[model samples]
Every structure is written in structure tokens, then in C-alpha cells.
Target: MVKYFHNGLDHYFREGDLNKVLSLCLHRFEEHGDLGTEFFIYIENAILKNKEYVLQNLKNMPSDFALRGVVEYGLGCIAASEFRLESTIEHLRNAFSLSMKVLDVFENEHGFCKSVVPFIAKEAYNLKPYDNLKDEEILLPKIKFSKIEKETDFFVLASCNGIYFDRYFEEFYETIRQHNENNIYHIHIANPTSQTEKLIAELDDPNFKFSFENTNRGASYFACMRLFIARRLMENYNCGCLVSDIDVRWIKSPSKIWAGLNKADFGWYPKPGPAPSLLVHAQIIAFSKTQKAFEILEKSNQFLAYKLSEFPSWCLDQSSLFRAVCLTPEAKTQDFRETLGDIETVQRLPDTSLTEKQAFRAFENIEISMNSDGYPILSRVD
Candidate 1:
């Protein structure tokens, strides 16, 4: 079987025999554990060099065909490499809406394909979710999470680069600790500085846990990877999670937001706009403990991995979330802007330029807490 598959790789692909190629690829993947870099390179080269024949055959295949989606993604990769923006978006949107699971094969093909977050955001525009995809048909990255000694009903998740540790960590920590309504706070540190590691060690509170990733991918990459972290934490704690920006200050107990999960698998406030960033605010997003929610998180991780390889820009996190939402239409979601009104449940701290002292000073003499009606309102201190 292995010999037949190995010998037929070139003949099947050149002839645009997608099924035979996919079958052989899957057989190899199942047998050897992974198809590896060599397999992906061949597939990418076939798409890029034989673009017309490969894409025409892929396009002619039925929309429901998994190989069609995989090949279209390869085409998108080729278009992106050549800086063909429109074609990249068109092919990617089709690829996503058709069979996102199949594109996992290209997950390791960063060298062969080029992509940017803006192009991904453009593709997500008007993109529809995969129709009737079974849970078993999806492929998700396997990430390991540390066991939380004490599981809480809710968890607030965030990540930050080592650069912002001293300037923002204390204030961010104090605000959540003081205002938290029985929620566990876990922060993922990306490329932590000495001081960042020291402080987290000194704190040593079970309720305040820390995770670290030793990569110099900067703040945006760290931010984009938070959902994957959140997904892992959810698995460990067996609870709903609210992923937030480190710059956000909680006023009311996010239990109110947690309650919103009863109606949907995911919840976030969307700004009224057409742009991907504006479509979904990433400062605060609530994810329920449901398979649908897990699927969306995994899809977001997949999109993040693909786009970050190109090192686009800071707001790719939001764009990736938007793309995941577009691809997982069955994952019920709630827009908090509608239910919460213009109330201040949480507030963003000052811009990054401001020191922690300045950020705390901004809130001095002002108080925000939950009122009798369970709404967080701002009041002046006497």
C-alpha cells in the first residue's frame, strides 16, 4: 500500500486526480502519523507551477469535495505569494467555507505559501460558515494545558509581551484581583523579561496562575495566540472563559457576561462597521464550554497560525476571530452590545504610552461597581 501510494503521487497529482491524491495522502498521514514537509512541498509546488490545470480541476470538482477546498487553499497561498490580493481573498473564502478541515495539511507549509492578516480579513468579508459540517470532520491542533489546582466557575484569560510587564502588569493585576467576583485570573506571558518572571513567581497565588511561551514574536503574535491558550485552560478547568486584553479593567463581576453563554457558545461586543476589526472587538470575548465553541477557537488558532507566518500587523487577532466566526456559523454567538446597552461593565486603560502610574491615576477618585440592578455604573468618589 505504501509503495503504491509513493509511486502514484506524481501521476495522480499531475492528472488532477484529487480523490486519488487525497486518498494516498490521507493513507500516508494515517500510517506514518503525519504527511510531513516533503509531502506539503510537493502539493504546494504542484499548485503554484501547474496553477491552471490544478485550479481548473479543483474548481470543476463539487463544492462539497474536501480536496477542492484543500487545493483552493493552495491556490490562495500561490496568489498571496505573487501579491495577487483579490484572487487570494476569493480562493481563501471559498476554501474556508467549503472544507476548513482539509487545509490542516498546509498547516506546516509556511515556507511554500505566503499570507497576511489583511488578506485574511478581506477574505472573511461576507464569508459564510461551513454548512452542516460534522464535529468529527474538523481537525484541531492538540495543545496541552497545565492542571489548575482549584477550578473556578469562570476564568479571565489574557496575554502580554515582556516589554509591557512593569508598566502594565501591576495595575492590571490589582484591578482584576480587587474587582474580580470569584473569577480565576490566568495570564500567559510571551517572551517574559526577568522582572516579569520574578513578579509572577513572587505572587505565587493559585487563583493567579501564569503560563509562559519563550518566543520573541512581539505583542501582536502573543495576543493572537490567546484563544488557543484559553481553549486549553477551558479544557483544564472545565469552565467557561473570558479572554481579554491586558489593558482592560474589570468593574463588575464578569459573571454577567458568563451568564450570556447560556444563550450562545461565544459572546463579544461588535462595533458597528464593515471592517473586520470593527466587526468584533477583541478586548473582551466570552467562550462557553461547548464543542461548537471549541471548534471556533481551534479555527481561530488555525487562522492565526497561517496569518502570523507573514508577520502582518497588530490587529490580526481581531481579523482571525472574525474569520473563525465566519467559518463556524453553527457556533451560536451573542453580540453584547445589544443586551448590555451602553453600560460600562469594563473599561480599557490608557494607551500603551502611559505608565502604570498614569493609568491608575486616570481612574483615581472614580469608582465603578455593580449596582442593585446588576449593571456596572461609574460614580465619583467623595
Candidate 2:
């Protein structure tokens, strides 16, 4: 979610009636964001509407078998709606526990009705994390939440037409070394031009995985490759692959970014520029190849896949990347969003008191350099 707010969610929050949105979501799955979100919003809104869903759920539950766990979880909402009273204590306890685990999946979402789990956790069970809540909790219960479910390990595929951004390459490689694990892999897909061949060769030290793909289709072509990469990674590595823009420079240690991203199914950051709202950028993106990232990725990708090569070829490569991530695939994404955790970029610049307004200014006047274990330009700097 954007700090300032102005994008899709912002518009709805501002213009749409909250009560109406909730009412529709309760009765229909297609009324809200996506299927997952529809379920979440439905429950949360239902509680706001009547508190009966939560009460009904308390009366009935499921047997141990295999069905749409999401659907079963949806049924659990019936119990969730009655979170406050001390009577359904066992039911409320389970409601909070279950939603707590999946809270990140749906809570505090923007742009779309994507925040299914979080929404249910919030209104029905009065859930939501401490930081996220408007009213802080007193006499807070100790939350021994286990963890968010893991999706597929996301493999970042970065490519360029002739000259690759050596700075980004170094940083990306470094990000992998610093943050990657068995669940996370960094893959670079590029076709550098001859002009930078000498400089490209100068980028030594190898821990990177490279692949060849044609670079003639302009920037949007990368989007197409990302879908292919996601398909390939899911099929071969049992994960999803994201199309990354090498231009994203790390402002902090990539490990921290990866850690936060691990909590979500898919990962995407907003662009630095201005728009009607805080627009998300695809420079650093991960496909929901794993179960987790898929929701996030699909939410972002759905809008992007159709709008191709709309910006500066390389500069706008990611513009559409996040949009494509919003779309849902045929198969259910496996939960790996945090499995290996996110292998993302992080910046290591010293924290400062003053904030810069410009987007790219953070790295301006700074020389792009590297350390051991190739880093992405968006990774830590020494």
C-alpha cells in the first residue's frame, strides 16, 4: 500500500461507499478484487453487515480432507464474524490464529480487492497487525503466530538488448549472494549490445545464472519472457520467475527487502514518479510462481500484460510487469512466496534525516560499484 494513497484502492476508499462495498462482497465472490479477495472482503463485510457469518461459522466447521482450503477458510469466516464476545472463545481463538497466519495474504491491500484474508481477520475477528491498526491494542494477547505460508521461490529474469546496465547487474548479483537461498534463485537474461561489450566483460566474479533470449522486441518483450519464465520455473524449478528491471538500485540491504517480501505471495514496489496515485513499478518484481507471490503478482500483472512497450524501452520495462502479475493463472499457485523468501534488492546507504523528493536521486551523484558475490544496483553498497 502507498504511504500517500491515490491509486486504485485510494479511489475506492474515497469515492465508493464503504458500507456498500462491504455488503456486495459479503453476498458475492465476484463483487470485490479477485476470487481470493472476494472471499476475504465478503467475510469482513459480512461481519460489518450482520455478524451472523462469524456466528454461523462457530456452529459448524470442516473435517480433515482436501478441498479448497481457501473455501474452507471462507466457511471459517462464519465463526470469525463473532470475534469480540467471550462466548465463542474457542472459535474466536481459531479465527484469530488461522487469519493471523494468512493475514498478510489479504490485509491492508490497495488498488484491488486483494486483501481477502487480512480484511476478514480485521472486521470479522477484529484482526490486523498492531502497526496496521488505527486503534492500538491494550491488554494485548500474545500472538505466537507461526509464519506466512511459503509460495514458490521466485527466480528473477533480467534481460537487456545489447548493453546491459552493468551497475544493475553487479547489484542484482550481489543481492543474490546476500539474500538468495535454496528457495530463491536469481537468473539474468540479457543480450548486451557491442558498445558495452568491453565493460560487460569487465564485470567479473561469477555466481550468476545467465540465459540467452532475443532482445529485439523492445521493453514489453521482457514482459512476455516473464510469463515464459514463470511457466518454465514453475515447471522445472517448482517456482515462479519474475521479470526484473536491472535499473532498480538497492536503497537498503536486499536481505531486509526479501524478508518483507517473503510475507506476501508476490512482490512489487511502486514507481518513484507521480501519478493519480502511487504507481507500482516493475523494476523489481517477482512472479507468484510459488503459491504466495501469485496473488500479489497476478494482481499487478493483470493490468500490465496488455499495455506493452508504453514507456522508455528499458525505463518503462517494469511499468507493465507489475500489471501482468495481477492476473490469475489456470493452476493454483503453490505457496512459495516466502518459501525461500524473496531474493530481492536492498540498498545499503547510510540512513539520513532529510528525505529526498526525487525518485532516482537517492543514487544520483553516486558511482555504481560492487562487492563480492555479484550484487544488483538495487542491493547494498559498500
Candidate 3:
């Protein structure tokens, strides 16, 4: 399920109605001298209707203001949409430089502006104007696993590209080390560098082993690889696996909860909502070493490949995994409180006042209530 953070303007922009959003943007600009949101809306609308006007307006913006950098970044997006290669690079480069100045000023400021700078920097580095790269160029590095030499109770699997490695993986590793020291961990790394190897060595746990994949396929491909890895471990070694995103941290060991569900082939936490929504939360999933679980994973892998080829932009491994669960006969929804006990998925919000620990406690409170009532609750705090 998708959740949107309300900036006290969601009612005005109901259902993302562009006209209503634009009207409110204009009103906000006039009342508060805040043109950041308004400029973005105008640039989005002008992408197809009037590119020249968008460019002119971006160029005329005061270069001293931080908002100008955001405007330029929007122009870069528009240029890429229009396949204007040289223009895309130029605008993006300018945006990068201007945004750096803004970052210096707002480095300590809370909320949306501060949260967006790193994203802009990442996009500036990764965005390529070329459209004719080969399949091999787009394909992630090939993955190979070390032979399973010992019988392990369960495998915890995760993957990350270069961008998320430092930002999330290090903390994830530390949390697991502190909370789940007994469980074996097999971390699959994509596009591993010397730095990554050094970090793994420093972690220096006997139970923790890592394998590297050569390609840096995007997140969707990494998600696919996760399923593939889980299935392989089950098939070859008769071991169960728990797959989780790197952002997830274990506040307590969940091994007992998972082990108790011996009859289940596959288990997942449904996206919090009313019954019949049945949308599986793909971030954390468990699979027993069973044929049914292997079959579901195989089908999920196939579906992901199909989506990648047919609708690359629209495709997501989470969506594909949900579909796989729906099709599988033995897949069951496990309560988050029961399986994860005291786990939390940490998300950095635009609001700095709302620290991650605070966010986690808030979620724990909701989960505690839901667990008592046997109802799924959906909430987002930003």
C-alpha cells in the first residue's frame, strides 16, 4: 500500500487533481512567499505543453535563492522527458552546483527541503542521457553463492546497491548483530567495492558471510535476486530463509515466532488495512524449506522478469511478490507483532523533529493496539 505525507495541503490537492493543486500552490506562493512547490507544479505542467517557457522562467529565477536550484532540477527532469540530451546534462549540472549552495544554508533545517538535496545529488550522478544502451549494460552483475557447508537454522538475506550501502546497510548490520546474534546471516551484495569488503571484514562475525554480484541492476532486479537466492538456499540446503529490506531493524529476535509456524510454507505480513486488501508487505517475508514455497518463489521470479521486459517503469518486485502470494495456495498472512515481535522499519522523514526512534515507538504503539484487537492498522507519521 502507498502512503502520502500530508503537508497541510492534501485536502486542497485531493486525488492529485493537477488543477486544484496548482490553485493551492498559487495561493501558498502569494501568502507565504514560498514558490518552491508552485515552481515545481508549473515546470511539470510545462514539460509537454510549453518547454520553452519553462526554460525561460527557470533562467529568470534569482540565482541567489535556494529555490532556484530546485527549479533548475525540475528543468533537468523536463529536458530528460523530452530527450534533450545536451540540455538535460547542462541543467542537471547547474542544478547540482546550485543545490550545493542551498545545502550549505539549509543543512541543519528540518523538513522537505533538507531531505531532498541528497536525492538530487544521486539523480545528478546516475542520470544518463543515452537511450540505446545494450541489455548487458542494463543488466546487474552476475551473482554466485558460496557452497553451504553447514546446516543452519535460517538464512537472513538482504541486498543493496552503492547508494544504500553506507546509508542503510551499516546500521542494519549493527542492529542485527546486537539483537539477532544467534541467527545466521547471508548478505548478498551487488556491485561490491573494496570499501564494502573492508566493512564486511570489520563486522567480523563468524556467522555472517557475504557473496557478491558483479552487476548493479536497480532495486527491482535486486528484489528479484532476493527471491532467487531464498529459493536456491531452500532447494540446495533444506534451510528456511527470511528476506528483509536493509531499512528494517530487529528490536528483538523473531526466530521463535517463525519457528512456531511449522505448518506454513510461506508467511508474510499483509499491508496494514481492512481484510480482503490482502496486499502482502514484501519487505519482510519468510519461507520454509518446502516445495510449495519454492514453487511460489519460482513463479515470482518469472513474473518479475516478465514485468521488467513489458513495463519497466511500472514494474516493482513488491507488486510481483504480492501477485505471487495471491496465486500460491499455501501462502498465509502472519501478524507483524507475532512474527517480528518488536521490529521496526526506519524511514527518514523530511521533518527532523520526528526522530527515527520517535517514529519507531509510534509504530510500536499502533502495532500493540492492533495485535490486541486482531485488526490491521495503517498509519504514516511524517
Per TM-score, the best of the predicted structures is 1
- Candidate 3 Cα deviation (angstroms), residue 207: 1.3
Give per-residue CA lDDT, model 2, range 193-242, as digits (tens). 56445554675534334444544455445434554345444555565455
The true-versus-predicted C-alpha distance at residue 228 of model 3, in Å, is 2.2
Candidates' RMSD to native: 20.1, 20.4, 15.7
Q: What is the TM-score of each candidate against the true structure?
A: 0.55, 0.37, 0.51
RMSD of 3: 15.7
lDDT by residue for model 3 (1-45), tens: 001212423443334444454565455545644345344444444
Off by over 4 Å in 2: 1-154, 166-168, 171-187, 194-206, 220-228, 240-243, 251-253, 272-278, 291-306, 309-345, 348-382
For candidate 2, the per-residue lDDT at 196 reads 43
Runs with alpha carbons beyond 4 Å of true place in candidate 3: 1-143, 147-149, 260-262, 273-278, 330-382
Error (Å) of candidate 2 at residue 153 is 4.5
CA-lDDT, candidates in order: 0.60, 0.37, 0.53
**Candidate 1 displacement at residue 154 in angstroms:** 2.2
Winning model by lDDT: 1
> What is the lDDT, from 0 to 100, of the residue 182 in candidate 1?
61
